[model samples]
Target: MDDITIDRVLKSKDLLNLTDEELISLVEQYVPSQGCSGAAYGYLQIVSHICYFREHLQSKLMKIAIRPIIYLGINDHKEVLGFITGEYLIEKTYKPATEFGRDWIIGKLQLNETLLKDIFEEIVIEENIRF
Candidate 1:
């Protein structure tokens, strides 16, 4: 493993030490629009809290128990960066991004019709590619 890549994993492992609420908040910041469900502003001032319950079995394990590795591979003239262990530790809302990406696209598409249509093109085509 490259020294730089090893360092990055160690840093992410640091994130695992944070409380679950803190970790979820970080993810929510990256993805508030999806959770808000198209409600950008006040939608009745009911007090709210976010809670996630891991399956009883998985909760006992420490997040760092997951593997720690990163990979560099090329695709479509780009270097693909992948972390082997971010899979288990990242929240399920991110399970899509962690493994297959359709869930990520689905979350975004639910927020934007235009984005949904673009992703739904009947065939694999050039020029539609995003940079």
Candidate 2:
């Protein structure tokens, strides 16, 4: 996707107004061609936008956005998942909102269950930590 298209999609105030199908179509058309890093960035951008709009979005929309990231490559998954997990760990307000996104990706992608379990445990520990 060109910069113009990316801007148009990302900058649109009507993003939340779009039907789930339309949102999924936009993600499918724009995200995959950007290659691994670019695609991961694009997926994160979309998720950030969605998170900004509401604390939660439809799971189907989140799943559709995640598909390209997973399909791109396993290494890319580390980058994307790391960023999401990092945000959750550091951002006090993100909490279960980020958890929803992480869980959706974990459920959709075929990755090592044990590694993901470790990550989940870490997040749980961090969540219970007090200043």
Candidate 3:
């Protein structure tokens, strides 16, 4: 990634605001090689998992939503950046990133449309808690 791209990513918004296609594009850009499916593989899984859960989370009784959190550490002997679901850390949401993975996630989310209307509509619905 270039300096300009890095700058854009640094200024990008949150991940839940990105469209599915944009997120996929970011995944492709960061994990370019089809042969070595490491970060990209994990990202797609995370997206799918979150989207799948969005419905169940919408229940009045349930009242929960999912988002990815990045973690930086050493994985498989390489310094890795990872994206995972949930506001905080969890075993299931862990997916190690590498190279320019962090930038891609942040960049895609930044080039936003205010909301994701299609695949994630329920996830973004405003809660009217009239307490």
Better of 1 and 3 by TM-score: 3
Model number with the top lDDT: 2
Q: Across residues 1-131, which tens digit of lDDT does each residue of candidate 3 receive?
A: 22323123324433345544454444344432233233334544433333332323212211111111111221211111222211112233234332233333344422322322222333333422121
Candidate 3 residues lying further than 4 Å off, grouped into runs, are 1-41, 44-93, 111-117, 122-131
Taking every candidate in turn, the Cα RMSD to the unseen true structure, in Å, is 17.2, 11.9, 15.0
Task: Kindly list the per-residue Cα lDDT of model 2 for residues 1-131, writing each as its tens digit.
Answer: 22334345555666656655565566656643456545545565565455445434434344444444444443343554554455432454312333434454444332444443444344335545322
Against the hidden reference, what TM-scores do the models get? 0.20, 0.43, 0.23
User: Relative to the true structure, how large is the alpha-carbon lDDT of every model?
Assistant: 0.23, 0.47, 0.30
**Candidate 3 or 2, higher TM-score:** 2
Off by over 4 Å in 2: 1-6, 32-34, 54-58, 68-80, 85-131
Ranking by TM-score: 2, 3, 1
Model 1 worst lDDT window (10 residues): 42-51
lDDT of 1 by residue, 1-131 (tens): 21322123223344334455543344333322333311111110000111112222121221111101110111221111112113222423322222122232233322344422332231114324332
Error of 2 at 61 (Å): 3.4
The residue pairs found clashing in candidate 2 are none
Report the lDDT of model 3 for residue 18: 53
* Error in Å for residue 101 of model 3: 2.4
Best by TM-score: 2
Off by over 4 Å in 1: 1-11, 32-96, 99-131
